[model samples]
Target: MPIFRPYDTPRDGAPVLAAGGVSRRRLPLNFSEEDLPLFEDALEAAIPQTRLLELEDVGVSPEGMLFKDWRILPESFSSPSIMEQFLDRRRSVLKFLAANYLLRRRRKFGRDCLWIVDDWSAGYFHWLADALSRLYVARDAAKDLVLLLPHRYRQLEFVQSSLKAFAVGSVEYAGAGEVYFCRKLFMPSHVAPSGNYNEEVVRGLREMLVGFYGREGAGSGAGERVYLSRGRAPKRKVSNEGELLDTLREFDFRVVHFEDHPFEEQVRIAAGARVLVSNHGAGLTNILFMNPGGRVLELRRRDERERNWFFNLASATGLEYFYQLCDPENPDEGPHTANLIVDPQLFRENIRLMLAG
Candidate 1:
């Protein structure tokens, strides 16, 4: 009943402290069942990198935007050519290096303006995978690229309606100097929920949500079973939610609540679901507007260990994920780990075996 292992020691002269996660645990020197596929291949998968690493000596000071292809925090890597990835999040990265050093000192946005300093800017799947990485890059690599964003993020109404499905722009602040990111690219950051999911960030968040709601038309007709009802968040409630919404309304589940609709109708009801069913929150990051052989399930809370970012965005958007941990009438009430308490006939037999398979 003891094993634990991790430090493969050689974090190339190791130094950078920490950012999080590393719950070392192990037990099975000679356990049975062929080591359960080496404990499910040492479960921790989230690898998704869609290449964007552009950096031509990025600098800009006054506290941030240094970038040598920023994305450092994997528990502060000790380096192995990962060259100590970095980020200075006291946030909005010093208001995007003081609005790119006052728009390159009043030369008014030289090199086609691309100053998008983000740190989950009010998350909705972390600003749809960090502000559209300049509208999915490769527009002749970076010609006349304009993705400013900083006008105090226009009071974040889903960041001003997701910046009208960009080709977007902003930045109305001034106060600092020494800017030179002549089109620096890194795109692909967020790491909170089992590593990080990438299929180019679920195909640039499903091509900016079908270029702002259009994949098979928006709204009305959206209902192939949804049930994402998280209700006024008192800590991810579902404590037998009226017997799990009467057993998910006997199967026609369309219980909705991506914050009471309107983020383009919550991507047209998660692209007219084909079975979503939620209990984890952030409205299951709209399952990246589902549709790619869909079916999510996900409901965990018993023993809650948080963040697997929508089960690794349901395996990078191929969505057929399923989970169900619930069990808490009061397992020590008050630590608030998504305070759930559902067991209504085992959460309706795991939602009737996930709607009968």
Candidate 2:
């Protein structure tokens, strides 16, 4: 790695070129581990000499987790910084990611292919969309643009939105200029297995699993559920960690609190759990990798919403699903007990049904 200067999109200090004018702009290729196996396979089959950079390694997220708490990017591309400062100590994780991948596009492998994997849901969508837009803009001289997204149907919908945007229009930010989108080379598929994953990736995942289990052992239930809600952010926004914690406490069964874990970790955690529950959120896409006979419960906001994603995932993995309703009376308004929102009595009954099968 030559440690080139970071790509200054905001033009904080140095001179930057215009998009349609061309002065040398940065292009990012983002993907995720959930899409790894399929992405790698497709890339190798299509362009095997391509180099890869884990967005986490270089520092980026699909939903812009790195940009949280700031308004540097527009709302669609906006994100909450994943990094948290504990007791005013160290910079958060997102800061580290931004610093590392900011402007340094390293040359790895032999090809010019730069593979970026989005570990956080919705975090990488804007980046992927913007990069595609750039490629499309530079189409006269642009090289091939390849994108790998999770193959599952749920994830496909998000990718589809970006691709549609690329084919039709570009999204513009105040300082960042217009981002073009292209449907042709922006391939969305399943995750391909890694051939050269670092020791840290493996070790960290294991530690995460251990930590998850440790929490499970200490909690009321011996199980974990990855709650998937719609969009990248939670619809019913609660204030502070205490309110969310209070929401989780309302459920009667022993449930491990699993929020904002990476897609890979979600799979690892779901596989180890006896039951998995989600609210038709994007994270439910990970259920495709859950253990056979693993249980799933979905809480839908409305009755008519389509969940072919859930159906396909549950069918493929053989995980049982128990769909329940969010108490209309509670209406997810204000701060109410989790039990009232979910109706603990009904939730327990559904869990019983899942266990029965």
Quote each prediction's TM-score: 0.30, 0.36
List per-prediction Cα lDDT, in the order shown: 0.52, 0.34
For candidate 2, the lDDT comes to 0.34
Model 2 lDDT, residue 77, Cα = 21
Model 1, residue pairs in steric clash: 72-85, 193-307, 193-308, 193-309
Model 1, 1-357: lDDT tens digits are 001111121233322211334322232222235334423433455342323333333433322233333322232122222322222233543454346545555322344444444433445655665444333433233334454443445556766676566543433332344344444333222322322444554556576666677643435554878788766676767766776777777767878767766677777777777778777767787777788777777776655544455655666666676666676657776434445766667667766766675
Task: For residues 1-357, write the lDDT of model 2, one tens digit per residue.
Answer: 111112222323321111111111111022224433322322211111111211211222323222222212211121223211211233443363454345334222221222223333334322232333232333322234333332232343334443432323232111121111212222111121121111222223333334433332334444454444332344432112232333345443333333555433444555556666655444555454455566777654432223233543353345565566554334555321222245555555665566565
Top TM-score model = 2
Give me the runs in candidate 2 sitting further than 4 Å from their true place. 1-254, 260-264, 327-340
Candidate 1 wrongly placed segments (more than 4 Å) = 1-110, 121-124, 128-143, 146-165, 168-211, 215-225, 229-246, 249-251, 254-277, 284-339, 343-357
Q: What TM-score does candidate 1 reach?
A: 0.30
- In every candidate, how many clashes are there? 4, 35
Looking at candidate 1, the ten consecutive residues that score lowest on lDDT are 1-10
